[model samples]
Target: MTERRHDREFVRTFFTSPTAVEGEDDSAKMLRRAADLRGLEAPDVWVPDNEDATAPSMREEGAENVAEVVADSGADFPGEIHPRVVWHRDDPAARYRGFQQMLTVADPDRGAVDHIDGFVIPEVGDIDDWKKADEALTLVETEHGLDRGSLAMSVIVESGEAELAMRHLREEVGKPTNSLERLFLLVDGEVDYTKDMRATTPTGELPPWPELRHNTSRGASAAGLIAVDGPYDDIRDVEGYRERMEANRAKGMTGIWSLTPGQVVEANTAPLPPETGRWLLSAGDRRVELDDRDGAWAYDGDRLSLDETGDDYRLRVGGDERRLDAEQLREELLGLVEYVPSMSDVVDSMEEFEAARESGTGAIAIERAATLRLDGVDVEISSDRMWDEATYQAAMTPIRLFQDVYDHRPDQREELEERYGEDVVERATTVG
Candidate 1:
């Protein structure tokens, strides 16, 4: 596998604020502010937007603004910087303008090239169109005397053809002459996609294309690229943005395009596991929260009971009681206890697994026991989860992500210390 030039662990938020605005003395004000952000406010990937976000007449100045802002302040900014340049599949003039802009911003003398990670190409058509964009970046890199395949190319899937292009990426990227291996992110452009599909809603708002998001995630996974959902237009609707993120997270898409600093803060923090662990139990039609005490979850409510047989226990549900043994009880509780593991829990589990591994234990099963007061009976419950090498590696991802944020956002140290405590913060940064 080819190693990535950029060493980003996890990209939770991709912030794309407009680069240039008309009539403003400082055309790059937004871009400058984004570069100045530190701590929790900073996004994992920052895109200086010169495409749809900027006016057509101001795109040239917008490109200059991208180069100037990053050249001035990007060194201190602890995030990957990628400028979004304009490009259309059918418009040769627009493509040429975008190519020129890329050349301007990517020139080594501009000083921004050192901080720039790649370029984001929007409105791509098919696999061929995507290759054309890749080829353009190669030409730019060659002209600027940079290393070949250094500048990664990310594309926006705005049309059906562009969405379909993702299916062929695995095959196309394996070719010797193809630089599609440098592709980084597959971002969705919902607005234009809805237009292209002639999709309409009663309110005329863009419909939630869950299928598109799923395809993007699958494509990214197949090609080993990062998948990012498109921008949430209602910037003030914080809950709505979070709901959208939850849906995206379910589909294995953790990154989202952020339009403002506030959205960046929300997006950056949403994907990380919760700070504390809690349990939820499924009731008739709803989920009930169980109390956590002394590292175990307990519940004492509703119509339920437990009857002990000779060698098995019967758990009551509404009116049905099923006889279950200890192992079966563990399985039942495992299904019932939807626990969102805290950072501390993950770290502790990982440490235990590591120690076991050092001791030559190939695998281990962890047991979590709890007690429930159902009706008049006090019944004990437990769950066992198996952990192996593969499981440990998967669990290490969030820890690595935490370390990445802690390393990059020095300004957020105090806040992180407050949330996770000094010891946890230290271990989190050092453990993985």
Candidate 2:
């Protein structure tokens, strides 16, 4: 079966740290905490400066030394958790050496290379640097007998030139390599970027770098790569951190680097927009309705037409269409609802959900009920029944008002308050 991409999708809380002794154990402890956090993917432990001048002479020895410390600290966790070592970007030959050392320590039993997932290259100022890093990594992989796609690589976009380089690499040259998966935006690069832009503010607030943040996100998305926001340096300012995280999340960033353990919870708990829930529901419904039969199917103003040709099926969905075998179609359909739990599982877990299912309500109806309950709306009846019953509708009057307020349509809110009492406007807006 084709792996469901949604299985890989979640709030990525990457806890990064320098390889220093003072907070090394503290960092590991946070990694363990992150592993246990619900709705969070495996934590990424990023160790920078693996190939720099101050790094150990033998890269394999350095990796093993770090592994020993990680294990000794009792922070090791199962699943996809892995450490990414950052390589120096100035010299391709040095990076190649580091990659070779990284591979030499790839002993699954020792939890060395097995847990060392990828490498990060810092200060990639142009497409040439990116291409060179790719070539160096590829050469190392070839020499060490590592699979070409086994290790993921990410570049740090720390300056204006680095941002432009990313755009050029994506548009002009394509991905530097197949293994390069993410472009990390270092918004707080102290030396080159901050100095060049004169971004420091007198008030000491987070600098207004909307252009940098937005462009980094756009460039990553355009290249089909994950965009990771840099750490918020002011760890004590929780509210300010949250605001910045929300801004980045809105800009299509998949993840953010957490400089401290305190930031992880806020990072994980950041609310997705209400529209995301709506899209998931719509997509789930479409997936459930998909069948192997060759015919036209329509849902949510989108149409999917399937035609059988020999052993293959030509499937057309909206503007994009492709041919695939029956197995492939099944996998495609499954991918859409991979993140969504099965209706049976939902019913088994929640009494309200079970009651809704027993009443002959569909998945979408149950989803609506669950969503409403999560939004603090009391859902005693199934969504379908609530729509039909006048008394139930009366009970949901406040909820509908609040939803309208949350939706933020001025015309709709004006009409709603005029129809219902204006008192609802205050109640709706203030309830949350």
Candidate 3:
């Protein structure tokens, strides 16, 4: 497959206070902290809360600190590190001034521009906010004679109206010239949404507002923008935080926001597996033919094919072939099955199972497993059985057993038990 320009590895954002304390430099401290994090991809410095703090002065200090840090530090991180500054949302003119300062203070010789990235706009909720941000960015680019899309931009989606704003952004200002790169979805904003809908419960249990988060995430993905999950407020509940991160990651989020430094390691260490199913081959749309030679398989062109005969089948992809044993085949099949529409529901329900495992909620696991089994029935029926019956059986048998277990179809279960035996059914239902 052709690579997408924006496809990047998982990003971990570390947030730091903007202003310095009495005797310490905040920017220096943040840079040192980032250097210590080892795997941190981005360090975001928050703008000062005081309305009196001048944007140019703050930008000067931030830029100077970035330059000093890069000069002092060794070449440890591979890519360019852009220390981003969080812009003040209420003051559009000040935001414009900050970008101007960023350009002015940038030292080309020292690579200061490479280290000091761009701006992050928080709490973006409407078309007006987008317009103001766009205007400020435009002004900064024009004033400084900077190239369009020179700087990266991130916006926070924290309110109910964010979905509309996101759609507007996708249409009006996207890609090439647009500086907007990331959209952060904060969970705390769900409270505001609940309040707006009058759906808040007395027991502190709110409705499943994940649909809002999903909407924002899907919108970002469709627009080819990075969707970042907001920080988890409960610092003590690391497990809960990781669960939410995993769920969001499965839904296609590229990064997670962290409130504390401790969460950075966990966030950065989260496994982000590359997409691994399906392959397209051919020269000018001509289908390549696979020929079986002895126990191995060979393709006419530089394409890949899976040898399905032996227990340890070899899969060839673009001149590379690797032997996959039974267990590996099982794993590969599970991943491949996700592409099938009939199995997608089961795959989605598996997320709940995983989240429950992380949260230590045993009851939810059982419930989700039951749902998985019910969905598995649909998967079994819709799966193609005519082509390569053994492979088809390999893929669908587990799904059938999973369905039989929770489906409680006694006759069907008994028939499958007689055919496949009790041991096979138990193994398939329990683990598949």
Q: Rate the local accuracy (lDDT) of all candidates.
A: 0.84, 0.48, 0.47
| lDDT, candidate 2, 84-110, per-residue tens | 444455665656665654554443444
Order candidates by lDDT, high to low. 1, 2, 3
lDDT of 3: 0.47
lDDT score, candidate 2, position 307 = 64
TM-score of 3: 0.50
* Number of the candidate with higher lDDT, 1 or 2: 1
215-234: candidate 1 lDDT, tens digit per residue: 99989887888889999999
**Model 3, residue pairs in steric clash:** none
Kindly list the per-residue Cα lDDT of model 3 for residues 187-281, writing each as its tens digit.
23454456556786668865656676677677665565556666566779999877887787557553566656667546644432111222222
Candidate 2: list runs displaced more than 4 Å. 1-7, 20-62, 69-101, 104-110, 171-192, 196-200, 203-206, 272-432
Off by over 4 Å in 1: 1-5, 291-335, 371-380, 404-415, 429-432
How many backbone clashes are present in model 2? Answer: 0
Q: Point out the higher-scoring one by TM-score: 1 or 2.
A: 1
**Cα TM-score per model:** 0.86, 0.51, 0.50
Clashing pairs in 1: none
Local distance difference test, candidate 2? 0.48
Top candidate by TM-score: 1
Clash count, one per candidate: 0, 0, 0
For model 2, what is the alpha-carbon lDDT of residue 395?
A: 33
Ranking, TM-score, top scorer first = 1, 2, 3
Pick by lDDT: which candidate is best? 1
